[model samples]
Every structure is written in C-alpha cells, then in structure tokens.
Target chain A: MTSTTLTPSFDEQYVATRKVATVGRVEISDVTKSYGANTVLRDVSLTIEPGQVVALIGPSGSGKSTLLRAINHLETVDRGSITVDGRYIGYERKGDTLHELREAEILRRRTQVGLVFQNFNLFPHLTAIENIIEAPVAHKRLTRDDARALAEGLLARVGLADKADHYPRQLSGGQQQRVAIARALALSPKVLLFDEPTSALDPELVGEVLDVIRGLARDGTTLVIVTHEIGFAREVADRIVFLDHGEIVEQGTPGQVLRNARHRRTRDFLAKVL
Target chain B: MSRIVAPRSETTAHAAGAATPATDADATTDDTTSASSATADAVAKSGPAGGRLDAGLRVVPVKHWGRWVLSAIVAFVILQFLWSLATNPQWQWDVFAEYFFAPSVINGLWLTLGLTVVAGVAGFVLGAVLAVFRLSKSPLLGAAAWWYIWFFRSVPLVVQILVWYNLGYLYPTLGLGTPFTTDFWIVEFPTTTLISAFAAAAIGLSLHQAAYSAEIIRAGILSVDQGQLEAAGALGLPRSIRFFRITLPQAARAIVPNAFNEIIGLVKGTSVVFIVALPELFYTVQVIYNRNQRVIPLLLVAVVWYALITTVLSIAQYYVERRYARGSVRELPPTPVQRARRWGAEQWNRLGDAHTAAAPPPPAQPEPVVTAAAAASDQYRTGGAA
Candidate 1:
C-alpha cells in the first residue's frame, strides 16, 4: 500500500528521455453492449475532434454513461469498433480479423486518456499529491521528481495547492473531486472524461466542481461529460446530445438542443429538470 | 408504497390524539403482509391504555435484568474455575514451575514459533499466487489454481506428512529437469538423502495452510467495490498496473483480517507435527511427560504457551484490521493501548471515589423543559425516538 515503494525503475528513463504524448480524435462506431437480455447501449456512434467538448445528457439508465465508457474501451462493444488517434482501442485490426491488444500496449495508450468519476475514486490511502502521481509514475514511467512537479502544478491548477498532503477522507466532497481532476490531469491526457462529477456533491458544493470543469473547457481539453446538470451543460458545452432509451434523442448546439429541441422526449425531460 | 399507507395511519393516530409512536413505524412496514396483520392486531388494542403519556415529566426507567443475570453467571463460573485451579493438588504446581522454562521446553517453543512463521509466510505467498490464478481471466490458469486448492484442502495434514516422509520409497531419485531428455541440467539426487522428516513436515503444513489461504485471499479480492476496477479500467491502465496499483491496495482492506485469522490458526496447527516426530511444543511436552510422568503439569506447559501466543496474535489482528479500515468506515476505532489506558483511569477514579464522597455534587443546572404537546409532536413525527 506504500505507493512510493512501488515506483518502477523505468519511470526515470521514460520521463527523462521522452517527449510529451498527444491525445488523438475519438471515433466510436456502431457500438452495442448488453448484460443478459437487457441492452444497455444499441448501435451507438459518435465522433469527437481532438479538442472539442461534447456534453452527453440523459435520464437515468439512458446509456449515456455506457457510451462514454465504450469510447475509452472500458466496456468492449459487441459489434463495430472505436478508434482514438487512428488506432483501434482495446483491439488491433489486421485484415478482416481483430486481435485484442497486449497489456503493455493498452497501458501505453492510457497515458493520453483519463477518466474522473462521480465518487472521486481517488486512492483513499494515498495523499492528494500521491494519488495524482500514481498512474504517471507507476504506469506512464514519469520519474519521481518530474511526477511530483507535475502533480504540484496540477494541484495549483485545481486550487488545491495547500491540500497536497491531505488524504481523500480529510477533504470535502468538492475538494476531493477537484483532487480527482488534478490526478486525471497529471499525465496531460488529451482527452478527459467526467461521469457525473458533481452528482455526489451537496448542492452548495456542486459549484466548485463545475468551476474546475469549466476551467478545463476554457483550456480546450477534449472532454466528454455525462451529466444530469442541464444548467452546467448549457453553460460549458459547445454541443449537447440528449439520449433516451439507449439511443440519441437529439444532438445540436446548446441553443438548439436546450431551448429549441424538436424531439418530444427531449422536451419532456428538459421540462422536468429545468 | 409506504407513502400511500403512512398518511392514513398518521391521521387515524392523530384522531385518537394519544397514539404511541410504535404504531407509526408499524404502518410504514405494512407492505409486508404478515407485518400488516400484526399491525392490525396491535391497532385493535389501541385503547386509552395504549395511549402515549407525556414526554417531559414522564420517566420510564426500565431495568435490563437479562444483562445483569447473564454477567453474574459468567463471572461466577470463571471464579469457580480459578478457585479450583488454585486449590487442586493434582495440578502439581511445583513441577509445572520447574519444567516451564526448561532448556528442552524453551527450544521446543522456539521451534514451534519458527515453524509457524516460516510455514505461514511461505503458504501465504504461494496462496496469493494461486488466488490471482483463480481470479485470472484465462480459463487454464483458473483451472490450475482450482485443482490445487481442491486437492490440498481435501487431504488430511497427517496423511500428507506421512506420504511425503515415505516418498523416497516410491521414487529412488528426484530431479528438476525436462523429463525423458538427455540434457539433465538439474542434477538428480537420491530422494532419501535429500528429504528429511522436518522438511517433509514443513511442506505438509505449508501446503495445507495454502489451500485455506487461497480461498481467504479470493474472498478478500471479491469484497472490493467493482466500481473501483471499472474506474481504473476507464483510466486506460494496463492489466498489471490496474491490479498492483488499484486492486491490491483496496483488496488489502478485505484480505488482512482473514489472512491474520489463518496465521493464528497456523500457530496452533503446528502442534499436529507430532505425527511426524518433529519436536514442536506439544510434542516436546509429551516427551517430557512420558519421562517424568508429571502428566497434568506437562500438558499445562503446552496450554500456557499456546494461550500466550494466541493472545499476542489476537492483539496484532485487531491493530492490522484497524489499519486497513481507513476511508471504508467513518472513523477508525481506538487502539488497544488507548482502551487500556482509559480503563486504568476509570478504575483509579473508582478506587478513590470514597475519599471524594464528602464533596458537594455540582450545582444542579437549570433543566430545559419542553411543553408536553410539543414533545409528543416531536416523538410522533420521528415514529419512535431513540
């Protein structure tokens, strides 16, 4: 459980000799997922450019989270494929057959993509700075010193500079969520995904988390946010996609989707929440 | 469902204007058919006698007779056992004192401790690998772990030890190399010359311990929240990284408690090595008793040593469990040292209480009283006040 002891030897070499990696555009095509007879997602397809921000909004169980998960290869598709930066995710396409990627390849690819979750999912045992540097130093092979500096910069970015030594349990919900953001940003991933980042926070604590995501959006980080906050989405997202019954109900600019949605389901859902 | 039924009962209770809070809770759980029937029976008896009295001035000082009776019985039994042990002549207290720290007995105790630690560590390491194999994605790996656990756990340790001791008879020579190949890189040795009785016993003990440890570790791994694995996956960490970094640390919270349980079991389990003629504590005590015929005292030596070891291990288990319980629970419970300190202070205060009896009690503070109607309303809203 002592993370400092588990830092791999390659960390120094990878950080000292390598250049920063870039994240690529994401492509998810005709992806479908199911558990037993219950279909979670059905033939979903979407494309996000390198620096574009897209917000996915939906009612509970509408498959928005599943679609976001499929993009990062967390949940594999039963049919069709997804690619990031022109390379197939989780699998390699050779001729007509597809072969799953090896563990090393998958890890190397993960450095450019990061995920932040509703519960923060920060390693409760580690301090804030340690949590931020864990993946970078352990998997990405960033040297200990370099990872520390990067983590410190990220803590400052998230307005948690004084909380580097605090454990997740010691931090408030908003602070923990901000620390999670810092951890995700540690690797300078090109794409960042948030799944209901503020849903676990109290009403008053929700604004701080939204502000951090707003900061990321202003910096042009390619983000796919699955959220229930209609107001936050309209303010931060360039495009909003409404999902219902495992399908996209409507997708357009904030003005078009939020104010002038043509779909009946979208309007009904908007009416209830708004 | 509760929302629909709760209001009807609440209104009826209000109409009676003196209903106890018990019926309010009963109405919420009325969805259970059996419970509703019980509620109906209780409702039928909601007469003036069943009405709730005022809260502020009313004092219901119920005594817990069951707790006191059980505590007294337990205390009497323990005291009687201690009294018997002190007065009994058959115990041979002098002989026990003489043999307790004998060089032979001390060596045997040391051997028992050593064997427990060495075998316990080796077994746990082996079991951890098997556990990971059982949990591995590959079917072949899972099958290998499953079969090993099954075989080891099924066989008796005594039988295993005896079989290993006699293995040399079945196989004259044992070697590590590719079978049927001319290149014998791993040198062959006569099995009788290489395998000793002590080594055989250790192997049997470790293998037996491993089967149990593997299951315990697997249960620990299974206890971790699945969302943790999902989030780590979404972060694009490699399989190994995901496991060592995220999975193992979180799983440690679950693994440490049962793992220590196995270690404590292994400590006493070392006594079974007497079948192999190994000089562990119990075996040494048996050897002494056979020579001197101080039967009860010699057996007491083994019992005392075991009790001491188990007590130490129990304390260790408590602290280890507390260490891993961080973040999972609201707060970690106090350590044994802190609890002992507090107990000592309380006992000291009790002993000195008579000297301070002449001191006047602290001036009575003004009692804040609520209107009976207000208190009744508060209790009514909560269903039942704690």
Candidate 2:
C-alpha cells in the first residue's frame, strides 16, 4: 500500500540527473522530410547524447544537411517527430493525434537550439557584441548589463574579444565565423548546430574556424556539424554518420566508420575520400 | 623488311640523341609520344581560339550616339518653340507689368506661402497616422484607414472647398444652440458667419494632401527591410520604440526625398484655391487682371513668384536630403584651408579675451585691437563658414 514499494530506490537521483542532462539531448525518431515529390530525409532516426559531437557527412543531395535543419525545425518534416530535451519541436502529440507546432511556439523552441549558418548571417548593421547580445536581451528579456557581460565573456571565449565592437563587414571571414559562434553561444542553447561553418571561408581562414569548433567539442557541448572537413570529423567527432539518398547508410565511431566502413556505399565514399 | 629498316634507323637515331634507347620498344614509345604531343598542342591552341572568338563576340561597349541624337532633336524643338513665343507681336510688356507687378499680387504671394505651410503640416501628420493605421493588423482600423484614403482621394479639391464653404446651408445653427445644451456643451453657429474662404481652402487642401502623403508614407515604410523589424523585436524593444527608433529612423532616408516633392506639389496646388477666392497669389493676380485686363502680364507674375519659391524649396530639400543621407555615407572631413581659418579665429578670440582680461590697464587700446581682429575675422568668414 506504500508508495515506496512502487518506486525504484534511485528514483530521486535518476530524476535529478535526467533533469540536468535533459537540457542537451536531441532525439529524432522516424523523421522524414520531403519537398513535393522529392524526399530529403526518409525515416531517419538518430539519438544524440547530451554532450556527444555528431558529424553528419554525405555527398551532395544526401540529406545530411536537411536532417540537421529538421532537428531545429527550420524546415518542417513531412512525418515523424523531433524532440529536444524531452520537448516536442515542430510537432506536438496529444492522445494519439499529432499537430504541427505554431510559429510562436517554434520560435520559442528555436531559442534552445542555436543554428550557425554557412553564410554567417550576422546582422550587418549591429556590432559583433550587439549581434551576440541581441537574442538574450530581446527574446530572453535579460537586462542589458547582464547580456553585455555574458556576450563579452563569450566573445573572449571565441578569441574575438578585440573584435567585439567591429561590424561583420569589417572582420575577416574567420573572425566573423567566430563572432557568429559567440552569438549562438550567448543564448546558452541546449544544442549547437553548425551548417558547414567553414565551407564559405577562405582556405587560409578555414583552419582557425575549425579550431574554435574543435575547442567547443572538447568542452562537452552537444554539437551536430554538417561538414566536408572529414579530418575534423575523424579527430573531434564522437560519432560519424554517413548518409546517402535520404537514409543513414552507416554510423559508428570515427575509426570504425571512416577507416573500416562495412557498407558498400560507405566503403565507396571512404575510398573516394581517402 | 627493307622499307621498315630505313624508317627504324631514322627513328633510332632520333631516340639515341635523346639518350633513351634505339630498340623496337623505344621506336613504339617515340611514335606514341610524338603523336600525343602534337594532338595536345593542337587542342590547346584550338581551345583558346574558341574562347577568344566568344570574347570578341560578347564585347559590345555601350554607344552614346543614339542618345546624343535624341537630345539634339529635343533641344532644337524647345528652342524653336521659345523663338516663336519671343518673336510674336502680341507679346505685351506693359500689360504684363500693370497686373503682375501690382502691390496686391505681392501680398497674394505671401498669403499663398502661409496657406501652403499650414495645410502641408496638417496633411502630413494626418497622412502619417493613416499610413500606420492601414499597416496595422486590426481589420477594423485597416479598413477605416483605407476607406478614409479612398473617400478623400476620390473627391476633387475644388468640390471639397465649395462644400466646406457652404456648410452653413447644411446646418444653419452649426448644431451649437440646442435649448437643452449647457453653456459648455453649446456649439456656436460659426458655419454661417465665421467660416472664411481661407478656412475652407485649408480644410480642402489638407484633406487632398493627406491622401497622397499617406501613399508616400506607406511606400517608405514598406521599403525598410523585414530583418530590421526582426532585429528590433529580438532586442525586446517595445512595439512603439521599435517603430520610431529602429524602423522610422531607417525609413527617414527614403521618406524625406518624396516628402520634399509632395511639399512642392502642395505649394503649386495652392493655386487651385483661387476658385474659393482665398486671395492667394493667383487670386490676387486675378483681381488685378479683372481691373486692368492685363491677362498675360498678371499670369506671368504669379508664374515667376512660384518658380522663385519652388527653386528655394528645392535647394532646401537638397540640404535636408544630404543631412539624412549621412546615415549611410562616409563624408570627407573639412579641408585644411577650412581648418586653418577656424584655428585663426580661435587664436584671435583668445587674444581678444586676454586683452579684455587686462581691461582697466589698457582698455581703450585693447578695444581697438579687438575690433581690428574681428574685422579681419569677418572678411575670412565668407560663404557661411560658421
């Protein structure tokens, strides 16, 4: 008759840790996305651990980038569900019925998922510090002083403390990318998504940006990077996923996947890449 | 065998000089290498020729000859028309001076300017409000704004003035003298006795100007980037602050130029108020022409004044636009000459101050020195430098 008999002994401890880690884990279940007759992602299912750095790699039109965008609800999925920190994003389920989340709700959820685009879409008019503190002050209702302090700290962390007052147009591509990363981190997001953060950068500048991202991975931040930098993936990523034609053809540790791929498509991809 | 042996000897000699070999294996290698090198050289040269040909075909510099010819034709036509007008025997200078230079017409110019200023200010404020209302999300407000714009725009200025001037006929008492009305609540019957022609003209002109100003304001607002609004929203700026601070400040650059044009239009449109006998420049000219019958000269006076006023307005508009454009442009700093003059003035002022501070000792002498320095400074301060 006692509730102690019904519950597990470590329920309290488990609940507390679960609540803490719930801030970071992103789960995608049977997620499928399509544009009219063309499907981008088909029945893609993946679970990213709280601090795991996942690299999504594939040839062009392979749906790797689409899956990353779907996780943030930038693109609506045709089927299935994506959940971040146990909260349903883009779609809500109620008593066996599912409905797409409203725009306001999606915006609220997007605050928790930070996306860094390849183009470094920093508001050109605002200074780097202004861009970094924009969301915190506006969306989170943080005081200007607090937001400024946090933004300054993040800018320093990204090695752009001196460039905080500079406009996006004045900074070099690498510096802009770093500022963008700082801007994303200012929100204290649960997950950071990088959409080829260095693909648009000059070859000489690419290494510096990749270094910042690698440093982020080391700090145990949950990251989903869609990238062409296979070397970075091999070195920093906890799990490397190879996608092909809207399907996850193979996924494993970088060594098992990059060097000893079992699937023929993965083998062919590695063969060409190596 | 004899024929093959002679060719092989020639090939072997060619290979031996290159220090490879003179064997049959070398012979086949030499043949393949010679053929492939010749093919590659031909292809490389041919590829560039095609590219060069395409480049040559694509190179078409713009020609200004057609524009030059069109401009010359237009100039000739304008000159011919002006020549006819100048040579006409019917050009009456005396008649022009009698009506155009009349004192009444001068007063009309002042009246015209005053009316335009009043109407333009009222219309612009009303128009801005209507534009904001039209852009609002509430259906009722949007519909009301649209309806107001439509109604005002559809009616002619002359008709509006006539209706307002004659409003006394519609409501004899001006609805102010009901028996039950308290002294505070009572409305006076000013429509019949107090409604002047100037009042009617202002009301009519302001209503018409408001409609056009609304369109200009709406276009300016729409020209702003959506990202700016989003950025402001993200900053958590309140709705009103976001609009006035972020959105309107940016839109000012676009809005100012058009608003200037509308002001000039309002000034010219004031001439239409002559129908209501508001005694504006054109109406004053009409009065002179009525007495003297100097039709052409009187009309010319009004035309000249309008041109002069418009020219001044245009210059003012240019400076205002330049000021607003500083938001985007990186202006050059003042020249060294300007800086030097500024420094000289400052030094002179300091000297004057020192002299004044030593006052009672040599008051008269320092006064003269200060005057001399000021005169010198005044000479250098030409072109409104200050």
Candidate 3:
C-alpha cells in the first residue's frame, strides 16, 4: 500500500528486465529420465529462442510436463543437459565432468526460472500479496517497499489489485492460479513454465486463467506451457510440440502442426484431444 | 355435532364394539363408504389408515414410573451421605482446617509446586529433542530415541527414584573419567553427594515425563501434510525456514492438548517423590496424620490443595489451547472473558424483548440467565476485533 508506483527501481531488481533484452534461450539436449525401470522421458531435445512462446501438448503420462520441468531442472535429466539463457540449470559442466550444483546454486538458478504448478500451490498461510512478494524480498535483493511495489504492479497486471489482502482459499481456483503466476513472476524469472494450469480448474473458470497467460504471451515473456487447451495453444504459441509415449512425435508452427500433423502418434493424440 | 357419535377422542372402532344399537350391517356400510373415499390417502398419510391411530386404534398415555423411581433412589443416597457428613464427629472438619495452613504443610506444598515446575520443564525440553531424533532421517538416531522412550516409560517412576537414591552402592563415585581405567579428567564427586533425595526425585520424575512427552510431540510432527514440505522444497526455501515457518506452527495445534495433559499429570505425579523421602504434600499430610491419628482430615487437606492446583492448571491450559487454535477457525471462539460479557449483554437484551412483548417477566421465578449459549453467539463480536 505504501509504494504504488511501478518505478524503474523495482524493474531494475528483476532478472528478466536486467538481461540485455535478449533472454530465455532454453536448450535441451539428449535428455533421458526414468523412475526405476519405467522411463518417463526419452532422448528429448528442443531449443527455444528468446521470447519464443512454445506450447507442449500431449495426453497424460506422455512426458510433456516432464520436459517443461526439465527446462528449470525441477527434474534432472539422466543423460543430457538443460540450459536456459546459456546457463546450465541444476548441474554445472566442466569439460567431461557434469557435477550437480549445490542446493544454494540450484535455489539461485531457480529464482530465475519460474514454474507454475497445475494445483497453483499458493502458500495457504500467506495472503495474495505476501505470496507475490516473498521471493523478491528474499532472493531478488529488493527492499520491502520495493518488493511490495513490484508485487502490487504484478497483481494489477493480473487484474487482481483489489485482492491484495485475501487469503488463497478466499479466491476462486482461476484467481488462485493467477496469483500463483504473479508469485512466479515476482522475481522476474528469465523463463516461465506452466504445467496443465487450467486442467484443475472448472470449465467456466478456465477462460480467466487462459486470458492471463495470453496477456503474458502478448507482452513477450518467454513461456513454455504444457496444456490440453488446443485452441488456446493454437492462438498463443509460436510453435507447437506434440508428444506421445515419452517422445516428441512432431513439432512445427501451430497451423502446420494442428492442421496437418505428419506423424501417426501426433494425429491420433490430436484426434482424441481435439 | 354428530347425530350418532361416541366421545370426541375415543376410537370409532372401540365405540362400535361397545355399541348395542348399531347392527353389523350398519357398521359394514359405514366402513365401506369411508374406505373407498380415502384409500390412497390412508396409505400415504397414516400408513394404511385414513387418519391418525387415535381415530381408529386404542391408545393410552404411560406414566414414567422408572424415571420417578430412579430420581428417588439418587436423592435418598445423596441425602444419607450429607446427613452422615453433617452429624458425624469422626469426620472432623475442624481438624482439616487446623493443619491446612500449618507452616510445615505450607512448605511441603511449596516444594511440591517447585518440583512440578522443574521436572515439567526439563522433561518437555528433553522430550522435544527425543521427538526430533525419533523423526530424524538417520536410522541410528531414530532407533536411539525409540530405545530411550521404551526403557524409561516401562519402568515405574517410584522405583526409578529409589534406584537413583541407592546409586552409591553401584557407582560409588560419579564424575567425568575415561572408561575401563581410572584416568579421571575432572574431580570425582561422591555419588551420595551428587544425588541427594531431592535430586533423585527430580531426575526420576523428569525422565518418566520425557518418554510420554516424546510420543505427543512426534505425533504432532507427523500430523502436518507432506504436500507442505514438497511445496517448500519447490519454493527453494532452505530447510530451516521450511521447518520453522511451515511445519512447527501447523504441528503446534495438534501438540498443545497432549502436552497440557502431561503437565497436569506431572503436578499430581510429584506426590510419588515421597518414596525417596522427598517430603512433598502427600508425605507431609501422612506425617501429621500419623502423629495426631486424624487420617481422614489430613488427607482431605491434601485433596483440597491438589484440587486447587489442578483447577489453576486446567484454566491455564484452556487459554493456551485457545491461543494456538487461531487461524484454524474462521473467528476464534469467544474467550471466557468475552463469553461472560456476552452473557450479560444477552440477559439485558432479553429484558428488552420481554418489555416489547407487553408481558413483564415474572419477579418471583428465577430469571433465565442460563439460556443456550448459541443464542449469545451473535453478540460475541464485541471484543475480538484484534
């Protein structure tokens, strides 16, 4: 409430804004992951240029969400590397040795890559603005007033300025998801990932949440969205990657992929989903 | 109003059975007319009867003979006990009050309260550590906690104090020294000097209380959701922040009630220290009664003191529980002070309601001060703005 102005001071503390207008080039190379004998991801490789909005569309258990999590190193790849904006996440490579970074390094890198969960895991104990301001004050080196100012700006951006003091339970599922997105954006991460963000919401609530993501896409935030909303993906994403059975079956521009998917797995999956 | 009818409340069938004027043919005709008229209505409204059972079936009210008999029996027993207490000289009330505030007895009560505080604090601190150890990720640490609780909880507190008192026979001297050889690093104090009766009592009581407290704390920790821990991990908050901010606050709601139960028990349990000749309240009462040969009155004095302490502890536990129970409820239940105020406000409002109803409340009868508590729930908003 004290600092309502979105001054340059708050913007300067953001990692994304400080980057030289060139950020979030995510690289995934030869990535493989498994839980026990059941491999969840297999030899998945993709590249995203700065400000490119990519949509990963697939059925359950297809490793589409796993691929999104790998970009932030929330899940480590068994045999490959994921780098966002040319910096290795979770692991540091020195010549042939790829040693896992310490927890502090992982947390520091995590502050730069934001992940929004399907459940919208807003801390239940904190109010909406507190949730938004927590990471910025803790990790972004922003003062309390500046963090509050930045959080207010983010909340206003998400069309929730009036909900500053409301607890998470007091908000609807869609509203809570938007608050979660605001919280992720608080530190101004270079890359943003959304995992089935609308799947947990009711059909009526899905549009408001989708509108928030659409606004982010319009404003040119680097986004990797794993979603089942085909029309939304077609409208918002620059490129669409379709996966089935733990491998990327096809990928192209939205029209090219959505209209005429070449692979059988991609077509069959789209046939059911669409 | 009826041309041919029995009394208003009597069953039609009963009246018909008593009738000498109506023939079987007339009765059959009446039954046929009524049956066809409301056959569907009978099944729906009265389960195969067109009206209530009182209209067609014989019924009578039963007196509550059992209730009267039970009430009489309870009143008789209570009256007999009161009569004996009032008339008998053997149960000397005068003797009870004479030694109740005696200096020696007061000192014993003071010592008892001191022991309760010391043992309760030490027990809870050790118990908290053991609870954390029980839940530690390392299997060795968890097993060590489990074994300590198992051993201490199994042994009797009185026996433990006795063993500590006679420890000189076993250890002879207690000090920091290298094991298996006599390479003493510090001065060795004699066992008798180290563990006096008071020390033995405190140690035994604290150890016994600790084992029970550990389980209460462990259960509280386990009650917090696993999702909260995962959420903290994903947020990249360090382990310390996660525990202090996320886990322990939530666990406290579950832990407080059980902890108070242990503390209240410890206050009463301190009387057992007398086994090691540490003269707490129970031993003090015994010593005086044995001299004067007025056992019942001296015992009554101990009971009264213990009851008073129990009442204070119980009140403290209530407020502590309320404090921790915040945020779990929508509006915290009114505190005892607020409740009393609200009750007073409600009585005044009821007088206003009676005045408006144009009927003065009876001056002779007892006023309804003890109405249902929910009636006062709306007025509870006065003091909880903070």
lDDT of each: 0.79, 0.75, 0.79
> Which residue pairs collide in model 2, if any?
A138-B234, A138-B235, A138-B236, B96-B297, B176-B187
lDDT of 3 at B187: 74
What are the per-candidate TM-scores when only chain A is compared? Answer: 0.90, 0.89, 0.91
Give one clash count per candidate, in the order shown: 0, 5, 0
CAPRI rating of model 3: incorrect
Q: What level of docking quality does candidate 1 show?
A: acceptable
lDDT string for model 2 (B61-116, tens) is 55899899999999999999899777875657666666565677778888889888
Which 10 residues in a row give candidate 2 chain A its minimum summed lDDT?
A1-10
For A46-125, candidate 1 gives per-residue lDDT tens digits of 88877677899989999988887777777777887888888876778899888988967776776677788889888776
Largest TM-score belongs to which candidate?
1
Q: Model 2, residue B232: displacement in angstroms?
A: 8.5
Per-residue lDDT over B1-386 for candidate 1, one digit per residue giving the tens place of the 0 to 100 score: 56434544553344345346456445544644564445434543553235334222233466899999999999999999999999999999999999999999999999899889888988998988999999989999999999999999889999998988889889878887887863456898888778788888888988888889888888888877787777666555667777787777778888887887788788888888888788999999999999989999999998999889999998888877777766655467778689899999999998789656666544675324534655778989888533
Model 3, chain B: what is the TM-score? 0.70
lDDT of 3 by residue, A1-274 (tens): 2112322233213324422337888998888999889898889899988888899998899999888877777677788788887778787888888788898788777777888889887766677898887776666479989999989898887778999888787788988998999988887877889999999999988877877787676566788999999998887788999887788889999989999988888888888989
Mark the 10 consecutive residues where model 3 chain A has the least summed lDDT. Answer: A2-11
**Which is better, 2 or 3, measured by TM-score?**
3
Cand. 1 TM to true fold: 0.77
